[model samples]
Target: NSTKPVIYPFNPNFITDYKGYKLGMSVEELDKLFAFRKENKYVNSAKEFQTVTGVSDSLLNAISPYFKFPDWVNQPKKQYTSYSNNKFENKKPIVKVDINLATQEDLIKVYGIGPALSERILKQKESLGGFVSMEQMQFIWGLSPEVVENLNKHFIVTAEPKISKVDINNASVKELAKFPYFNYSIAKEIVTHRSMNGEIKNIEDLTKIKGLPSEKIKIIALYLEF
Candidate 1:
């Protein structure tokens, strides 16, 4: 007579190679799971685990009962509450300010933006003469997507700044490199392309330049005069 190995509840997110083998997961399935985990992601549910590892439904069903996630994952979601009539009656509507004109004080009001970040934003704004588009906000170092979204809610590009547009056809590598979106390598590529080909006619021509960031061609076009 022999005793059977006892299966214990465990978080699928923390599965090890040995643990996966004990759960009867195939080497291929374990590899897939390990790959997903390597990306610093977690399998939130048994279904998600199967989706990530391509485990069979039968195998998932067999082991799902013993799967234990964190208490936060198991907690019941709070019920949504309806707002009272007076809750928003006294609140004033938000008036968006021009991003180009927004001061450090104004920028600091947004969540996640501190003094240093606000100063950086102001510096970036000043460096470009002023922001021609709100999209430029994404280029600011340390600005997260969530903070960008918040910034968008409180700012707009109502005022367009007067910019000294770069002459893409005649600008040297050093001159082209001055553009915020471009680096020395990209600037050199542009100069080389201009020398090989005739004058760059328009934004479409800039796209043909090898090694130029195709995604930022539109933004770069904003500051270029062909």
Candidate 2:
């Protein structure tokens, strides 16, 4: 007889179907429904409600219209906590990071640098000889002072860059190995080959050693100033 939703006065079972809505109920009944629903909040949608409550799709839809759902129903409202007065604001500036003296691992502790930017800082330092000042780091295309400032938070430059000499003609394996990145094997091969073949002509001569690859030589060449 009723194709559209059949409206009824109210049945306890029938009223439980609506997401707790009771259209034709007394105030006491409505209050009871509200209180019962408050204590026992249940899902109300066709897809999730049936899976959760084992209510059938048609029956769930039919029952949902009666009850007013819970207020804390949807996703939670995000509360923004104020951090304006936190200890981070009160942090003291103890030292200034000397960009020239810092390593890639050291440089990244500056606030905004991730692994990539830290490597970039190292590579840029290599290319430009070395960082003469904090300002020189900005020459890197994307390295900004604001980023440096955030990073500089815990940084302090304690040492100055020192000049060192390397003699292409006479650098021994042990002496060459003292350079930051030169390995024992590479340094040994360079000195042994040069000792047999006579003096090294230019920095490029070291690249021709049997085990010493050109890429490795190029990397070490940047650190050598003779």
Candidate 3:
């Protein structure tokens, strides 16, 4: 017998257009959030939400409890003390990681990366036959720029992959397509061009193929040897 998993309650921020209507907000009040969103600004606190929306106290009280903010915004404000009555500061330095060498455990030790994302990083690295540059990490699917910044703070690319590259002039289309950067169409184009032109002399030759852009030459070059 299949059992349904228990669903837990989650915070609902003023996300969709429906929430304001359901919560009994005035059209003018609801429009404020949409206007703010259009400007790419956020009402990070309940007070800020009220300030933006001009909601009455009763309405503010009803909705304020459900307002969710980012962790940085939620952090308590620091209090200053006199030098004579100084408080001790205790801190632990964040450990650095080598992106090329980090295991799942090491990846997880970074604040934001959980098990699934760590696994994905490792899997992408493995599929790529290991990363050739720190910049290459940007290509990992689902890694946001913010997380990439965090990863960069803690990690450095110290090594390049030692795997053998394909002989592009001789490799079959299917073999070339097996590489992550090349789909069958591009691979077929490469092979057909090589056959017609006699041999692909270097990565620059790929730029001559129609629809295969120069940016692709950089990525596809990683797996190809002249």
Candidate 4:
């Protein structure tokens, strides 16, 4: 949104006239519309107005020649702030997100979430039945309270996630690495170790790996399915 308020001249001499055109709009309406146009135009140009609003080039050209804002237009006096500022500062309502319902890219778009955090959110969603409220986001390992609160401002829970049942016994090293806690090396170790031993007998086997600490194991376990 534009931070500058719309400027208009107090004197009417700055107004321009075009043949057969009517300034039927009141001054207040025109000022409001002008401000709206300045902030909302997807394409910021005279040509865009011509193309989208069906205003002809010739009409635009005629208006262009007459275009002159009064002296006051050149000296803006006040700042423009969106009304959302006050509303945003208040505690937002709890919103639920189905981790399975979100695309990885969508998850990343959350305020405090990056690729790693997104993966963790997805994994947790899969492990549990899916998030029931914004609070569930905090369950993901390493997700901070501040980050969760920050995200609450922008995200809402809408639908249930569609979790894929991962066969830990058959999943590839690359697939395992996609888990938030297990990066390339850790995922690779799990795959290699499993290949040698056949299949993991239980979730506890994960902790037996040298570098796989209990904390990391618990996080990985959150998303794993038999």
Q: Which 10 consecutive residues of model 4 have the lowest summed lDDT?
A: 11-20
Instruction: Tell me the deviation in Å of residue 145 in model 4.
Output: 4.1
The sequence of per-residue lDDT tens digits that candidate 3 reaches over residues 45-103 is 77877888888999888767766666644442222123224333324456666687888
The C-alpha local distance difference test score for the whole of candidate 3 amounts to: 0.70
Provide the lDDT at 84 for model 3. Answer: 22
For lDDT, the strongest prediction is: 1
lDDT of each: 0.81, 0.54, 0.70, 0.55
Model 2, residue 119: what's the lDDT? 89
Candidate with maximal TM-score: 1
> Which candidate do you rate higher for lDDT, 2 or 4?
4
Candidate 3 vs candidate 4: which has greater TM-score?
3
Off by over 4 Å in 1: 1-90
lDDT of 4 by residue, 1-226 (tens): 8574433322222222321134333344345435434332222344543454455566667444434443333332222123235765446654654444678887665554668878877777665556545656654565655567766665666753444545677888888777545678877888888888777766788776656656445545645675
Model 2 clashes, total count: 13
Q: Which stretches of candidate 3 lie over 4 Å from their true place?
A: 1-95, 210-213
lDDT of 1: 0.81
lDDT of 4: 0.55
Against the true structure, what is each candidate's TM-score? Answer: 0.62, 0.33, 0.57, 0.37
**Which stretches of model 2 miss by more than 4 angstroms?**
1-98, 101-161
